[model samples]
Target chain A: MKERKSEGNEVKVRWYGYIVLVIAILFFSGVFTAFEGPLKALDFTNLAGDFGKLGTLEEGAGSLASNFRGTGGAGAKDAWMFAMTLFPTVMFALGVVKVVEYLDGLKAAQKLLTPLLRPLMGLPGISGLTLIASLQSADAGASMLNTLAEEGEITEKEKNIFAAFQFSGGGTLTNYLSSCAALFAFMTVPILVPLAVVIAFKIVGANLMRIYLNKVCKQ
Target chain B: MDKKVTPKKTVVDAFVEGARNGFGISANSMAPNVMFAFVLIQILNLTGLSDILGVIFQPVMGIFGLPGVAATVLIASFLSMGGGVGVAASLYSSGLINGTHISIMIPAIMLMGALLQYMGRILGTANVDNKYYPQLFAICFINAILSMFVMRLIVSL
Candidate 1:
């Protein structure tokens, strides 16, 4: 009975799923970043919000503004404070990801990605969901791919190529927004810039593996 | 056809579950890793090893438009992404590298992030042939270096 519902989920495509999926993409895409007021709510970084500054102790002549972590701190105590500041952002991003997944936003994307997966990554369309799953959880994706390999659904070359994508930047979505929040403040580019780079390289890395397998492996 | 009914999970519930996971991850993984990075940076600074590193890695890192000290972030990132970011943030705080350098280092950090850990988590679990592991590792390092070039171009623009 549980299997039936799970199958239905994979087959069913709700009309609202596409809409919410697009909204979710825009939310993470930084497209609405420049908008004002409530519109800014659509952007990830804006909704993640900023901390209150300590403000100037002196007049305009000598500005004294600093974050709650302050300045000139070193070692573990300083790292502790810095990490503390990051918790809220990570929490918000994960919470939103969960909310989107609950709404079937990611499944909607998986559906769309299924066809493109082949031409894009040299993967079969059936591996689309697993590839999407890899972005959220490395263990889950790896185990699922192993299942595919065990069942003889994917060829050895295909498994290796997919493994290449998963190896570098594994669990990308979770790790990037959550684990790498420390570098967010220092980044001069939009949040998506680095993410786009990582994703592009994941594909490139997989194709490079593909080239190696085709040319050298002789399998 | 008997269909078993399952209760729908509300959006709030989903968010709560994920947020709870975030708390656990931050406490267990991120916080300790960053603290470890901070201590590593301190040791490098106090031992005056950072300067020596700056001198040694200068030529290699300069190719990526990064300072020699920026090499530490990439090195730490190879072990754990959180540590790499911590090293980058620490360097930024010390005024060794600015926001532009951070932007350039961003993609490279995660492209090669947590490779040693994921070697088992990703490759071992997936059960890829052991013979290809060397090539797989090489591909990731190549991807990381290549991405830095792309990020450097974006930063310049």
Candidate 2:
């Protein structure tokens, strides 16, 4: 984590990053899905568009196209076909996420998260900031842990406990928000409630790991 | 004061780089994992394991005021969070589960979601010991189950 300051390099969070982050959130939220107007373009489902619908000659009378999957399919063959279709969605999403990162959008998020996660993670010093980075990306968090371990700043048991915290809701912010789009509209509670619970449980899970390592594993 | 020297790459280049990474993950990780899930589900159907599972899980699901079929959502989440939510949405639309159930499930799903993949991504990347993997997974399960109970209580209130 200290690597950032070695050459006096602190991340610059441009104002545009916040705007990009908001747009990114809306793009995935599916709010524009029902809009028939220009705002429909704001939605990922609308932006990716749809596969060509078969005309009267093929399936006829139906404006809705089932796309390539088509009806009953079983076993590996069907699985392959469906996975093929998912490629665009996953690729497009990460692509947008990448743009967000390049534009410092993730840093914009990190600035907000650092204060919250710092107290929750309870690391003594600079490492607290690194822990917050883990909330957005699993790789980033794990790498921070790896560095901390290498530096001997964290004990093995603490490392294991931290692993449990991260493993439970890996990439909590990005994965939760992006993947929860489908369930978001249907949720009766406010959006932040579930996310807050997930964070709380991540810590709960870490303590569970701590107990197991201390009492059961004894490793 | 000289402005910070930003990299010459434009946003479009960043997007392409990001998209390439996405393609790689889809091809390597997601495609195979999804295929594995699909085949596993098919085998469960063939062996009548799904029905057996439903019967077994119903009572546990009942504690949350959900149907036995809701177990599929949790199971899917264990494999992948998105998949779990997909299963929940489909079930909800079909009227098998209600809005309250989905609300209660949100945290539970996020807590346990994508463990199979994250084991490699998070722990392996962190260089955490191999022996700790099972216990860590168990912790996730414990957390998920506990959260559902809490969420159910909250929603009721």
Candidate 3:
């Protein structure tokens, strides 16, 4: 009975410790307002004007194509413009992530994360590779799991636990870059509170999934 | 224990390697989705479809602790992970939302990755028999919603 009580206390302390650590990280990351003040004061009229000019050029091309071919080229033109603008950024981000990995950054990252993640997630040290890969590239993470399964690095049981943790915890960097702009648009007190709640929920949700898989699924 | 150890690469080498790996992954997976999203958003913008969608989603936006106008970013973020970023950039570039809005939205967006769903699909492919996909999705979706609510509450205070 004393041991059980002590164990309970330990769990409670650990849980609260996790919460405090997460909150501290978020507060310090400046991820909350990396570009708030300057972006808000920018002159939008000129930017809109630039977009208008691009639109006009697109329109001109569409009219020319329609006059010659009797089919409006607006859709094609819009698609092309959008592709031209967004593709490079995605490519650039992907490239950066890859280079990070090829240089053994992920291996180093795995070593650093292994100590904390293994105990916290109840996963093996090898699982760190999958988690780190997931952060940069979701597909890579999945592939890593598959490879591990093939190599028998982990049992079917371990695989399920790994899956639960990865599913809940993967894809941090990509998500951040993708949503940074949208978040900047509606920054307000009301918005901030919900955002913080979501952050907490994500952390707790992932941890809960880890615990459930470990304790309940006795593969 | 005496296996020969490889020396650590320099920072520049690491950066270059990371870039290369990133390029390969992007080309294979992320690029196609990004293209699809870009095309979709462009068509929406041109045909004013986004505005129409914005109007439709306004009420739902309130439930999520966002303004009616902010629905555009939320929906965009959902459709194309980067769509929200584009919307935010446009709004900020246009001087529509202030710094406070930017601050609030950044963390919310950062924490809003569809990792749960993404992981579920990957695990499904791996033939892992534990059917926790629904539970995982629910946890992530609920967490995201709850986080947003809590963030709003804290910032409001």
Candidate 4:
């Protein structure tokens, strides 16, 4: 009876610890913090801020209206671009996944990937497809994981681990080319060097999550 | 001797079904996510909340050897990479930031960009439990910071 009581106390302490951690993260990331000054209130003098000029909160309403209309200014253009680029790819990739399923290609791929993934990331072979897709598109990779889980191809634990991997540096290749590459074009440092560094560390982070999930949330 | 064979779907049928399933997944999972995130990010972008965030995070950004003003670019990224790219390009053109600074910033930006949208759209569609979102963000942010340090060290070397 005493031992049971102590164990219960330990769980409570751990639970409280988690809550504290979450709260700290929120605070440090500026959930409670706000800047003081004109900058604090978004600048509306500029064209970007013109949208803000329509009315104090009107820009927000406009944004919502634009979303429904599937249109907007620059920001909406970008979002549309994202959808245009990714939606087709996702659509095509899903077809490919379908064909692969019929051909039993996933199993063959899994067999090939098992040695590498299981040993390094503690994930199943099927997760290899998701990883590869993640290089090009994180959404595709994540969606695939969802599909796999729903289909009973991977357990919940494996899904979580794979999700960790995707989250660490999702859209590895695409993002590098699109964002980092441009940012580095004029930089003195070689582009590949930083790119490689981010990838390596992202993998490290994914591994960290894998370890934690496996040990702590193994259920 | 007698042989038995199971009927199989024709290639065309398989392809059609695959396309259907693909579209279904995209529509059901990714479309709404994209729409919702687009709306939220649009609001944030137009309002310049991201700029406010930039000012607030200047000190922390300085730790990465980036100019405090670079927080603007970082904040813009949270809404969309294109905006982030635009901010970065302008900064680069104006000679506010250089290659070395960019090296550190790029990795960090990639980690934290598109926060609400990426979380709601990608991970949300995957049904990643909400409980893990904070943990995941924390892990990714830490990883970016670590990468920034490494990149900074390498560039300085």
Question: Which candidate leads the pack in TM-score?
Answer: 1
In candidate 4, the residue pairs with backbone N, CA or C atoms under 3 Å apart (3 or more residues apart, or in different chains) clash, namely A187-B99
Task: Write model 4 residue lDDT over B1-157, tens digit each, in one string.
Answer: 3333767677466657766765564556444434444454456456976457657777987888887667766666676554565566545544556766776677767766666677865688789888888878888777877877887787788
User: TM-score of each candidate?
Assistant: 0.95, 0.72, 0.56, 0.55
lDDT of each: 0.88, 0.74, 0.50, 0.59
On a 0 to 1 DockQ scale, where is model 3? 0.25
Model 1, which residues run further than 4 Å from truth? A1-10, A60-65, B1-4
lDDT by residue (A48-138, candidate 1, tens digit) is: 8888887666555765536888778999999999999989988888898898888888888888878777888899877877888899999
The candidate, 1 or 2, that scores higher on DockQ is 1
- Poorest lDDT segment (10 consecutive residues) of candidate 4 chain B: B29-38
- Ranking of candidates on DockQ, top first: 1, 2, 3, 4
Docking class of 3: acceptable
Docking class of 1: high
> Ten consecutive residues with minimal summed lDDT in candidate 1 chain B?
B1-10
- Which residue pairs show backbone clashes in model 1? none
lDDT by residue for model 2 (B1-157), tens: 5455776888899889877876776677666655665666667667987678778999989988888878988988897876787667555544667889999999888889989888888899889888888788888888988899889987998
What TM-score does structure 2 among the candidates reach? Answer: 0.72
Instruction: Looking at model 1 chain A, report the run of 10 residues with the lowest lDDT sum.
Output: A1-10
Query: Lowest-lDDT window of 10 residues in candidate 3 chain A?
Result: A43-52
Rank list by TM-score: 1, 2, 3, 4
lDDT of 3 by residue, A76-178 (tens): 3432343334333444444444444454444554555677655665566666666766665556777788778788877766676566544543455554433
